[model samples]
Target: MNIALVTGSGGLIGSEAVSFFADKFDLIIGIDNNMRQYFFGPEASTQWNQDRLASDFATYEHHTADIREVSQLEPIFQKYGTDIKLVLHTAAQPSHDWAAREPFTDFGVNAVGTLNMLEMTRLHAPQAVFVFTSTNKVYGDNPNFLPLIETETRWEIDTNHPYYKNGIDEYMSLDHTKHSVFGASKVAADIMVQEYGRYFGMNTGVFRGGCLTGPNHSGAQLHGFLSYLMKCAITGTQYTIFGYKGKQVRDNIHSWDLVNMFWHFYQNPRPGEVYNAGGGRYANCSMLEAMALCEEISGNKMNYQYSETNRSGDHIWYISDLSRFKEHYPTWDWTYDLRSTMTQIHDSMIERLAVTQ
Candidate 1:
């Protein structure tokens, strides 16, 4: 049987992968313990999504197993054996602030968990394609030091700089900067993913994603940038903008688009190849710009406050340079733009809130 194994199978990217590959793969095995709730709070819990997946897909098998525990993961891998054709590792401690609070938990989940996944894939399903959802945070605070210009609403790179046109690419240095506890953990995992591919000759691909936002995201204040912002806009909750005059720009890529990138990479099976993934120049916004768009979409002015202190290791203006990925996969491109994505988020949030109410 052709099985697709998705870690964090209830979260944004993981759930999207399950849905996208449902018809293609014979069976979909999911591993998730809903650690998100522990990392954030109950509001950030992915239980609702987990239940939804259970009810939606018969092909999907859910396991409340922690990725950090090899004993838990080994049984699943051993049960599936070589039938698992795809291993999409989307689980991680994905917050900069939360990571600082619990360094051990963060490292165990992000770094050790990733290592567990890589080693398991190597031992059990060596031929399966492994796709890791890495983040732009691996570059640390390097992007913040770029020659950026302040505009009326957002921060932008200098017009004359090469990155100004295409945004930051894989060539940017991942050294000599404060990477925060979360970023540092991710960097460890990111490098290992590449090493496994290059050294072991495993079929692995790493995508350093920008703001991975979608309707399915369990948006929290510390993470889920666009999702959480739109949630605040819809619920009339006060949203806080931390530092950089709220002009820190991030390119937003829909979860489906990112999963689609994974699909392409799986088909081609590039070993140790890394690509920058995001909305790129096509779909991006500043914090202020995002708030304005959220207001426009929800038809409610966002309740927001400003803070002088910015999150450590945060970028000022970082739009992904998708030129490399585009050049690699000529057929792949973004399907959702910023406005369309935000509108979907607004609509979806309304639907979900109504259901809960």
Candidate 2:
């Protein structure tokens, strides 16, 4: 029974990864303060998730503490994580739209919070395989570089580029005007995670992910892209469709696949590697495409209207060039496609929302 610790265990990604590893690990420890709600306020959905996990995962124990406080974190690391074998760090302030309100808060958590985790791991779980979830926003607004053709449903790169055959790759530049405060913090963290592995010889790995959505997500207008859309469509919540023609693109990956990468790398333990984790460009879709699926499934037209004000650090298109991960993790692939995926999330949101709140 390997002991596993996840920092942002209450979040959409963290909860999914926790569910995936619960049966396998001896005892899984989840650390989160649910403080994001303070930022997102009433719109934040994590409280429902925390309540559900407390009920469902009996073997899991959660601690309500901010990672920024070393005193709050050190004891936990000293206990279950003293020699913890795997650390899957899914914690971060992920809203590009919301980051501007407090750049320092975002930096404190995404950047300094990560440094705290790494330093603590160095002290207690030095040999532990550490996995960090980074965002595709690290590449900034890349799809802006491409010539996009808009369809009624979605947007795609021009047919001329050979690599557009797949989508954006790891080679795309991180330096661009599109990066918001969230992107800047994440970029800083992503570089440090890699640097810690290189400089300190830690078993560190980074995942620059596209949209990672699932049923556990506390979907809100600020984050949780797919689940938020599903909630709005099924539950009659209003949503905003920002610029880029609502044709801005994204490739949604299930949380299970993202965790599988961590699970595999944890067991085998990679030394400081970065991979783009997503459903690949093959599963790519635009906001219109996603809402169309939601509308089709729930039989409700989304109560969404387009806005000319493009959100900062928002990408017009940024699909994962997931070939790197696919070639390495041959045993792993997408278990859920767009339609069924949306359906499962919608049904779960209905069931869980009814039961929890």
Candidate 3:
């Protein structure tokens, strides 16, 4: 049995990833400093995931150390050494608006933190498979690239796109020239992840993901995406919808779906591969469309208001052209539909609130 390490184990993605890999791997190493507090204030979800893991998972090492601090991270990697088979680097300060305000901490956590992970991988687990969770934001404000049309529910690139090809491909320009502080940071890390594979010949892969959503989320109003939307609907919290007449689109993939794919890549390591991990055009939805679905599930209309101005670096119609990832891992596909996903997020938020209240 191979040992695996996951950074940011308290995050929405990291939380689900830890539970998913707990029994599967011989030993699991979960490191989290709860540094997401820098952006989301005291309302971060780090402790929730940590508590869940403490109950269910055994044969795991839980470290509360910041990845940005190299001294804190290197020891764990060194101890594991060749025993560690895979390293899933998911820890980062991921917030567009927050990144804009505090670009220093954002760069330090994402760009510098990633650099430290690479260094650790090179020093200790030289042959280990490195899987970096990237964002579609690396492509930046891609709404300008397409001829977007707004519908009652959602936005589409065209009336009839081939393969429902309403979204940007990996080949679309990453040279985004507007509101791109967050984009620039992630891009730096994304390229470095690939570079390590190419220049250093490390077994690394990059997943430029779109709207990764699921149940085990902290569900912050500003960032948690679908979970936050569900929280807004269920908790009757005021929610803000920015721009595109609330018809901006995103392909929402469940956390389990993405984590499963990450596992598959770990089992069958490929050299320096970059794949867009998302639900594709068919599963895509707009802000209003998803809110409607949430309302349908929760039996309440969303307490939401739309702002005329768009958020910085927000995509108008961005779904993944997942053909490349599909071709590589033919069996890798998402099972959850938009309706089901919204419902799941609603239920999860409800459950979380029951305990908190």
Candidate 4:
């Protein structure tokens, strides 16, 4: 049977993968232990999304297993054996602040857990295309060192810089920087994913994602920036901005767009290829800009405050350059821009809140 195994199957990207690949794969196996609750708290639990996927897709099989434990993971790999045609590793301890609170858990989940998945795929499903959801944090604070010009609402690269038009790319250095504990762990996993492809000759692809978000995200203050910001706007909760004059910038990509990229890559099968994935010049905004957009969509003023301290290793200006990926996959183009993305998030947040109430 053709099967696809998705770790963190309840997450924004993982859930998207499940739906996107449901028709392509004969069976969709999802392994998640609701570890988002363990990392962020009960409110951040992804059990809701898990249930939704189980109900929505007849082919989906849910497995409550942690990627960190080999015992829990091995049985599934052995069960599927060579039938697993695709393995999407999207589960991660995804917050820098939370990582500082529990370094061991962060490293274990982000680094060692990735190794576990890679090894399992190597042993049982060596032919499967392994796609890892790596973060731009793999570049750490390196992007902050770029020549930037601060405007009233956002920070932009110097107009004269080559990156001004397209934004940062994979050519940027990934060394001698302050990668937070979370980023450090991701770096380990990112390199390992690449190495597995290069050394083992496994069909692996590493995507260094910008702000990955969608309605499905279990939005929390520690992560899922866009989704959480919109939630605060809709709920009238006080949102806090930490440093950079609330002008720090990020490129945002909807989960569908990203997972679609995965589908293209899975079809082509690249080994050890790393791509910088984000909205690029098509969809990017600053904290202040995002707040204004949220208010416009939700018709509620964002209650917000600013703190002088920023998160460790946070980027002041980061817009991904998708030239490499685009050059490779010319057929792929962004379908959701910033406004459309925020609008969808706004509607989704309203529905989710109403359901809970």
Please report, in order, the local distance difference test score of every candidate based on alpha carbons: 0.94, 0.83, 0.83, 0.94
Our tally of clashes for model 1 stands at 0
Let me know the TM-score candidate 1 reaches against the reference structure: 0.99
lDDT of 3 by residue, 1-357 (tens): 588899988887787888888888898899998877656877665787787887788867799988889989878887779898889999887778888888888898889999999889988998999999999888777545677676778777775755354356678777745637887899999999999999999999999888888888776756778888877778798899888888888898888888998988987878788988888865888888888888889998889887898888888887888888778788877788888777788777788789889
Candidates sorted by lDDT, best first: 4, 1, 2, 3
Question: What TM-scores do the predictions have?
Answer: 0.99, 0.95, 0.96, 0.99
Stretches of candidate 1 exceeding 4 Å from the true structure: none
Q: State the lDDT of candidate 2 residue by residue for 1-357, as single tens digits.
A: 478888889888889877998898887788989876876776674766777778998878888889878899899888865558788888899898778988889999999999999999988888888899998888877657778777677777778975577777787888755788999899999999998899999999999999998777776788888988998897788889988878888888888878888887776666878888887765778888888889998899889888899887687877788787777777877788777778889899788668747
Clashes of each: 0, 0, 0, 0
lDDT measured at residue 90 in model 2 versus the true structure, 0 to 100: 87
Model 4, 334-353: lDDT tens digits are: 99999999999989888988
Candidate 1 residue-wise lDDT, 1-357, digit = tens: 999999999899999999999999999999989999998899999999999999999999999999989999999999898998999999999999999999999999999999999999999999999999999999999998889889999999999999988899999999999999999999999999999999999999999999999999999999999999999999999999999999999999999999999998989988999999999999999999999999888889999999999999998999999898888899998999999888888899899999999
Report the Cα lDDT for residue 145, model 3: 61
User: What is the lDDT for 357 in model 4?
Assistant: 98
